[model samples]
Target: MSDIYDLITKRMDLLTREKEVFADNILRSSVPGEREKVIKFKNLVTHGGATPKAQATGLKSTNKNHLSLSTHLGSTRMTTKKTDSDVSLSGNTINAEDQLRKINDATTKYYEMTSLYQSYMRRHNTVITGR
Candidate 1:
């Protein structure tokens, strides 16, 4: 009972179904990260309740004769270190072996997926809308 146009529409439905399945899986698998983020931000916004503004140049205890103040003043000492005459640095470099392995793995997967999709399109050319 199905003619060429009906077959084409049917094949389109197949592609549409596959697309929907992939989309539904992604949606169902997504964790409640958005809800968690909204709750965290709301808590942060509401947590700062009725705090008076602090003045600049604030001093603790306001007692200069305090033993703690003397100790704090004595602790603020400057130190001199040897200046480097020549600059030398070793930057973090990627391991060549690992880099090559990843490149090879990604290239193989890309080609495999590309070939599969190409084959599918070719086999279903008559049913596909655009050549």
Candidate 2:
């Protein structure tokens, strides 16, 4: 169903954005007065939430060993906000421990979502090919 695929794609997009934000936050943890970036999904609902269709003009990998490049689907749904927790001694709002934990969580969610997508495709293939 298109709706199911759209939902899964949106969720994966959100997770990807979360992971990126968390990674960035960890990198800025040591910088003085650097506020951590966070992902806010509430506004995404109002912001055209549709996934942009992929362009047909991109380069394609013609060989098994060819390097594959990733494309960003659209603008991120991330928003910056001050952390409510205590800032570090260096005036950085990012806590490395928290960022690491968030990154792990996002990674796990992404993996699960991908697995589900794969399972769906496998079933679809089986039905279509009768193999």
Candidate 3:
């Protein structure tokens, strides 16, 4: 349905914003007194008389060493905040390696959403067109 497509587009947009922020941080890693920006997602209540909520299922990290990915579940927008990462001798709060890792994660998520969108389109077409 159109709702699914809209959701996919919105999520892709969020990932794009995330990538831009991480890229900006990487670019400013050498600048003094520059603090890294982090994007956080918050839950919002969509008023429709408050129907009973269903249990949410999502990916979880089983190992302590595994890299944790942001879910951004049920979030329509993101809020940017200064990161608490330790600053280097140059007084730059951005860690290039960490930024790169975050960028990679965002990029991965973007592609995954793209793939899901394409798959949904295929299914939709199949349903509509007797193929």
Q: Tell me, by lDDT, which candidate is best.
A: 2
Which stretch of 10 consecutive residues in model 3 shows the poorest summed lDDT? 47-56
Which candidate order results from sorting by TM-score in descending order? 2, 3, 1
Q: What is the lDDT of every predicted structure here?
A: 0.35, 0.72, 0.69
> lDDT per residue, candidate 2, 4-97, as tens digits?
7767887898888888889988888899988878755554544344333322334444685754332333434555676657877887777889
Show where candidate 3 strays beyond 4 Å: 43-85
lDDT of 1 by residue, 8-117 (tens): 44334333333333343334323332110001223223323211121122324457565432222222222222333221243222233433454455456555655655
> Top TM-score: which candidate number?
2
Task: Report how far off residue 75 is in candidate 3 (Å).
Answer: 12
Q: What is the lDDT of residue 114 in candidate 2?
A: 97
Flag the better candidate by TM-score, 2 or 3. 2
Candidate 1 worst ten-residue window by lDDT: 32-41
**Candidate 3 global TM-score:** 0.68
Q: Is candidate 1 or candidate 2 better by lDDT?
A: 2
All models, RMSD in angstroms: 27.4, 6.4, 12.3
Runs of candidate 2 with Cα error greater than 4 angstroms are: 50-77
